[model samples]
Target: MKANVWHGKNKLQVDNVPDPTILNPRDAILKITSTAICGSDLHLLDGYVPTMEKGDILGHEFMGEVVELGSAVTNLKIGDRVVVPFTISCGHCLSCEEKLYSLCENSNPNAWMAEKMWGHSPAGIFGYSHLTGGYAGGQAEYVRVPYADVGCFKVPNDMSDDQVLFLSDILPTGWMAAENCSIEPGDVVAIWGCGPVGLFAIQSAFVQGAERVIAIDRFPERLRMAKKLRAETLNYEEVSVLEALKQLTGGRGPDACIDAVGMEAHGVGMVGAYDTIKQAVRMESDRPIALREAMMACRNGGTVSVPGVYGGLIDKVPFGSVMNRSLTIKTGQTHVQRYMQPLLERIQKGEIDTTCIITHHLPLDEAPHGYDLFKNKQDECIKVVLKP
Candidate 1:
């Protein structure tokens, strides 16, 4: 099998690797038909997330036919097309019972590794780093899916893979971001970043009954995409984001703010430089530029929803403002199983255009080029889908 393998910082190669076999009673092997390069994957590519090693498979948003299934997986059989959630969860755990699948205690074999960093471990994610379970990702021609009964969501026969692939990650992530906002009727939501997740956050905010959504980004193409969803746009490079939010909300700030841009936010001026210097010197692992702005821009008593990925320690978080303003902070890896079925219904009803953000398509062999384009935001590329 050929896979996109991580070598080192800014290095990836399409290499042939051994095919996966069922390793657990609940496991299934998928012959990947479609996979995507997620914004979070860039973290691994750039060495933001720790514990990644050479030869690690690198993708999580994927869908395919169940080529083989283990005996314990009774709900699915060969030939069933399904989208696998990135978060690997055992069905019987307390976390799964409570529908917080991402925090499932039984998934991550590398839990202790994560515990050392985060004090608690998250669910195993396909093709993330060793901090999560080191499960081979679906970026290849095939992958082994553990706890298949809980992770695979079978799609309808009529839908294309492109329409359903994001059900595996970003779509649900964006939806969860909006849900975290707890948008009230006629409320305004502000979102930072205009990438795939950010664009979906904009649309999902509308679906959750937000009367107005303000999108912030420096990319004209992404901002235009947000506007297509009826969100007012602000290029952070052109104006003071804090002042703009204040003026846009008539001095009250947005009811909620979503930081869809995670650790790698392109910060402006000295603060950006400070974060870069700190991170480069190994003093900080993430840049919390968007998070700081979100905390400050949110209205008093409002929610700050984070759908972005942060790998490690951050510097200079504005805890004072959050404490003073009584802001509620909600963040986590998306419990994708919780939202997949409902969001799939939205896609079936034509309410969400999942394909609108996809700007490039390439064969799996060209994944290296795709990654470069996406990482640099070249060619107006917001999303890239690879066919394996």
Candidate 2:
């Protein structure tokens, strides 16, 4: 089977790897049909996340047909089309019982490693890194899904793979981000970054009854997409985002602010340059310009929601502003399982369209070029779907 394998920093290759088989009684083998490159994948590709090994498979958002199932799996059978959540969970665990699937205590085979970093282990994620689970990702012809009964959501026959695939991650992530904001009716929301997650955040805010959404990004293409969704956009490169947001919100700032651009945020001045220098010198693990700006730009009592992926320690966050303004902050990896069925129902009901973000589709073999195109923002790439 050909899989996208990670080599080193800024390196990914399509290589022939052995096909996967059921490794546990609750496992199932899936024949992957569609997979996507996530913005978070760039963190791994750029050597931001640690505990990665060479030859690791690199994808998380994917959906496909079940080819085989282990003896204990009963919820699904052969030939069932399903979209698996990125977070691997055991249904009966405390976190899983509470519907916090991403924080499941039993999924990560490498819990100890994560414990060393964060004092606890979260769920193992597909194709993330050894820190998450060391599980091979779905960016291949086939993948082995563990805890199959709990993780795989059966896709309705009427829906196309493209329609439900993002339920595996970003769609749910965006929804969860918005939900965390607790938007009241007629509230104004400001989102940083117009990437897929940010765009989805905009849509989700509206779904949650936000009256206005302001999307900030430097890319005209991305900002244009936000406009199509009825969001006001700000080009951070062309204008002072904080000032413009203040003006637009009548000096109150947005009722809620979202930081959708995580570790790789770009700013127009010395702050961005300083972060770059710190990241280059290993003095800071992530760039927090977007997060800092979000904190500072939020209304005095507003919420700050973050769906962006940040892997490590950040430098120079404005804690004073966060505390002085009595801001509320919420963020985490999406509990994909919790939102999978709900978001799928929305898709089925014509409430939202998830396919608009797909800007490129390619065979699995061209994954290297796909990564380059997405990372460089080349050809206005917003998302890439890989078919195996």
TM-score of each: 0.95, 0.95
Candidate lDDT values, in order: 0.90, 0.88
lDDT of 2 by residue, 1-388 (tens): 9999999878899999999987889999999999999998988887777567999999998999999999999889999999989989998999999999999999999898777666688999999988899999999999999999998899889889889899999999899999999999999999998999999999999999999999998888999999999999999878888899999999999999999998787322111121233332233333337898999999999999989887655667899999998999999998888888779888888777799999999999999999999999999999999999
TM-score of 1: 0.95
Candidate 2 overall lDDT versus native: 0.88
- Cα RMSD of all models vs. native, in order, equals 3.7, 3.8
How does residue 150 of candidate 1 score in lDDT?
A: 88
Residue by residue across 1-388, what tens digits does model 1's lDDT show? 9999999979999999999999889999999999999999988887766578899999999999999999999999899999999999997889999999999999999898777666788899999988798889988999999999988999999999889999999999999999999999999999999999999999899998999999999989999999999999999888899999999999999999999998777322111121233333233333337888999999999999999887655657899999999999999999999999899999988888999999999999999999999999899999999999
Poorly placed runs, candidate 2 (over 4 Å): 266-288
